[model samples]
Target: MVISMAAASAPTTEYVNMYTLNLFSLAGGTTTSSTANRMVIEFGRGNGVVLNGSFTYGADGALSGGTLTGFEEYYAGVKGFDVLGASVPVLDFANLINANDFEGVLNAIFGGIDSISGSPMSDYLNGMAGPDTLSGLDGDDYLDGSAGDDVILGGNGADSVRGLEDNDTIEGGAGDDDVNGNMGIDLVHGGAGNDTVRGGQGNDVIYGDAGDDGHVNGNLGDDQVFGGVGADTLYGGQGADVLRGDEDNDWLSGDLGNDVLYGGAGADRFLFRAGSGVDVVGDFNYAAGDRVQLAPGTAYSLTTVGADAVINLGVGDQIILTGTGAAGAEWVVFA
Candidate 1:
């Protein structure tokens, strides 16, 4: 049964009547008491009412669930609810929740915005006001959650997407396409294409999948990056990071902080500068044409320890390139 309530922003002074209900009571249970299981607060305002509550299930207890309401905090169908202050995503069907971005799979189960957890609600999703989550299933489609915290998934095909505000997650499917996290903490996956991806603000995680010449930038955030195939360029901006150039020729640099870099295959370039924290490069193959580029006017010394090459650039700061034999001796090139 759907017990209703007013959205928190609704003024309670004008509410006619409010109901405190137990989940089992909706099925006509005995009475209202503390041990009555789940307790629901129904805020009835204007022409409708809506519900929001928290509950724990006892073997003989009740379970509480949130309800749908208009932006004005009324159970007035789907006029669409735009939350005030912070945010709560109006993602799929019926399940209009607040202050929480439920993370699971995008099962589009709603006729429009607002969803119950784990239901595939939409084939294509458009972002609404407030923190919204949108997902795409099994096709090349477009997704743009206009504002707030959003989650976008391009399950397959060449797709275009944008997360305009708050923390977001965007996954681009098999086809080459564009995906951008405009604000907040974001996680992006470029699946199998020469894709261009950028993390606009806050902390972000980016992955470049198999394809020729992919470009990725960790604009803000202590990001983690993986270049999964072909020639790729990865930049770690203003944060401690881990960069793995996996497969084929790649170019990588640890722009700031202590970082770990891996030149996985073919010829690769690992760059560093003075004042940047000590960074390490895993799997630096000298025979594969991998080279370490140092900033101009930087003074440094090189040595080998048990197949590992270390560069000491004064002030006890150093860069260790591991996983190579003495052939790595010739791998260092100052830029």
Candidate 2:
């Protein structure tokens, strides 16, 4: 003797789940718990916990497959979490996603594009893979573009940012920032405030754009660097490079490879050391207190060819002072 029952209908309650609706709503809470302020959503994998309102088929609470529309507004909080098993702590999602310690993963059937943003408070954002756009809206932020070509912005306040790999674009929007293009042909800008920027590898373009002072270095590859409007220090660390101090007093050094240097305005110092390569000093203003500083214990002689002054460092190394004459000799200094 067996009992037969009719097939049940679908649950029409439209209950909330960890992946579909705010978890706080399902728990009968209006506000997030103090400990649960951020939600971590890992894309590329569509998986999450679901809480049904009707308990149909006794499936009130279970893990279910879900999708992320990328329009979900629950990715903010305080404190950090590690993604992709990397020890790096990602930015907290406060006023953005409510999950004190709640973690969610948004599965994308086909690897999707991600746009990650931060709050007015400090944030730490890591775009682990794919071409992602990360913006630290306001506050001191830490941004890491771990893989793929990425766009990272340190919106406001002092920020620490890095383009870890591939071609990337990074900007230290405001406040003092530490910007590093760790490995890529990158474009970097230290927008305002004093900044320290480094083009770690590959041919790069860097700008210390308007600040009290800036330190910009092209660490490798053929690079182009500009000191937009400040008493800035520029370095062409390796490869054939171009460095310019656009305004105010500046110190320009072509550290290696045949390089070009420009002292755009105000009093400028052209620095050279042993193995600095054959470099050029464009716009050397003698009466403007411009000076040529040489390495310590270095012996050098100067000669005037036509209207230009040439400093012979050795058999194959020289600094050609374009359009400078004998008057340039008086400003050469030993350092």
Candidate 3:
């Protein structure tokens, strides 16, 4: 029973290089291959799966070990697929996994391949029907491209990454991480610290790089989030999500559908709970301090009528705050 948030700091940035997934296990667990290149696991689609050797494809296969056949083993999703994508602790599947039927964790990863896909010898690969490619280096790592269209990377520390189904691309490049793109059209990046990114259905693009705090979620579709700098918490958890709270003091949410919230400079807080359908706060910034949060017992009453700032959360849960004159009334607050 613990819930705490409100101490904000960050907003936006766009840069790409994200490559560092430090995963361990020389045989202890979490899948193998710590480095030295060569780790391919493909089958089912794309170029095609079934890299037969019966078992043992090490030595020149890179990592220099042995035995990799069919492949089939499961354990309840395994913390969302690790190594910089977040969720670490016992993620292994070398019981010689080869099953691709039930359809869940067996074919979900980089359909495009990684290390640029040039395939020096395949710098960490995972497929069974994938636009495949996987990468990881350093310490705390784990990568799971359990299906198609995959690209997973993580490094530094505290990593656990996954593109568990169709259309995937993940990057948890630094530390304090957890990434998941369980369906299609996925793209995730949480390159620094204090991170927890999730886009569990589709149409996702998330970035919370360089950081003090970031906990992002776009769990359905039509998602695009960027809160890079610190103190961030953006969740457009159903669909039609588009949030950008780029700087300090941020806590935005379009938690159901039909959302478009953006409070980009600083001092932001926009939350409208209870389904939250017709939401639109393009840049609800009144001065340098923007605010609008209502969901605690939720019996509100704030009227302006004329210019439109009606926030009556009781009956049908209406909240209309258009701008023009005294819009949103300087800034409404109810904790």
TM-score leader: 2
What is the TM-score of each predicted model, taking all chains together?
A: 0.56, 0.72, 0.35
- Candidate 3's displacement at residue 331, Å, is 0.7
The CA lDDT of each predicted structure is 0.58, 0.67, 0.57
Question: In order, how many clashes per candidate?
Answer: 20, 16, 77
Q: For candidate 1, which ten residues in a row score worst on lDDT?
A: 16-25
Residues 71-107, model 3: lDDT tens digits: 2111122111222121111112332123322222232
Residues 255-276, candidate 1, lDDT per residue (tens digit)? 8778888878789999888766
lDDT of 2 by residue, 190-289 (tens): 8899999998899999998989555799999999999989899999999999999999999999998999999898899999987887888888887887
**Cα lDDT over the full model 2:** 0.67
lDDT of 3: 0.57
lDDT of model 1, residue 177: 63
> Residue 231 in candidate 1 has what lDDT?
86
